[model samples]
Target: MQRANAELVRSLGAVRVIDYTKEDFSASGHTYDVIVDTVGTAPFKRSRGSLGRGGRLLLVLATLWQMLLAPWESAVSGKKVVAGPASERVEDLRFLAKLAQEGSLKPVIDRRYTLEQIAEAHRYVETGRKRGSVVVMVSHG
Candidate 1:
């Protein structure tokens, strides 16, 4: 909601924001170009709703077994719901670095924890509703 209020929501380039907590995103009937799904806690089946007619969904953290049991609807239909590992090539890293260097990049760190405060870091991250990445500061001794 902060992102929406800030008017900087477009920074992520996502046309519409889906708050999975408040509502079921599948009911929106909104077709997404690329749905990068990192969270997979659903069992009621909702792959089709997130994808367009020929859209693609990139599953980031699905297990090998889950990938093997890929959604039947997505395969039968033209829409592709990719499962399993996402290989990060050298080019991807380069692109990330380039983007980070650009003024368009900004790291949203809700909390910064020192290496010695690992427990505190875990606690902060367990809140499960962070806008962006949480930083764990590593001291170079």
Candidate 2:
């Protein structure tokens, strides 16, 4: 996590936000029961030490090799690694939508682009500088 987005992340219910640029959370000697990595910056090998006994690491995005090695690693070690594509259930989507509607959840939109500017939007996203979700508007007109 970047220092700039730390506050925003904390406001979103994160108990603690570690700026990877300043410190390495894995080397801090602290352990967690569950660690969800949306990006592949923290892999199983590097994160194993940070996990407590029977801790679970959820990898939202992982390589094929990592996915294949997950089960073996979990079996060998007491910690578990879960790597796979997320399952989108309609009920879950509806629940999230309800939360957003009730102001219980707030989404951060970093940028918005019209359908015609989609190419430019892709370029910006590829740069990996966007802090939040990029919206592409489809105009019928």
Candidate 3:
């Protein structure tokens, strides 16, 4: 996780950053009020067990399979798991823009490549060593 978005994590006020790749996240013995699984991988399927009592798991990239499956699991348990569509509306974009303008947040730019270098840029982004977002410089004349 640290390697995935180190700079963004640092600047975003994450006091303690854990590397999920190094160890099992559940073994940490910590509970969260809200679990936001952005990537929808790894322990996301097990998020219910890790949550504190009355905790909620918010799945951002919810798929049809996950949506149907998660609801069934939640119905039998006290902990609730809710999945939202991956679509982003204007309000969401506005909020993000506000955060940026307020200086509360900024996207970490791992690399900047010209539009002509898109293939190379994508290759670099796929390396899994990216510190943050790989930017493609696209210019319109």
Computed on alpha carbons, the lDDT of every model, listed in order, comes to: 0.69, 0.90, 0.74
Q: Global CA lDDT of candidate 2, please? A: 0.90
Pick by lDDT: which candidate is best? 2
Least accurate stretch of 10 residues (summed lDDT) in model 3?
40-49
Model 1 TM-score (2 dp): 0.74
What are the models' TM-scores? 0.74, 0.86, 0.72
Residue-level lDDT tens digits of model 3 in 65-137: 7787677767776777877565779998999899999987677787899999999998997776777678889
**Which regions in candidate 3 have their CA more than 4 angstroms from the true location?**
1-8, 36-40, 58-64, 74-85
Clash pairs of candidate 3? Answer: none
> Which candidate do you rate higher for TM-score, 2 or 3?
2
The window of 10 residues in a row where model 2 has the poorest summed lDDT is 1-10
State in Å the error of residue 104, model 1.
3.7
Kindly report which residue stretches of model 1 are placed more than 4 angstroms away from their true locations once superposed.
1-10, 41-44, 71-75
User: Which candidate has the top score in TM-score?
Assistant: 2
Model 1 per-residue lDDT tens digits across residues 12-104: 566766666676777776667677767665321566666777887767767666687667646677777678766899999898889899956
Off by over 4 Å in 2: 1-3
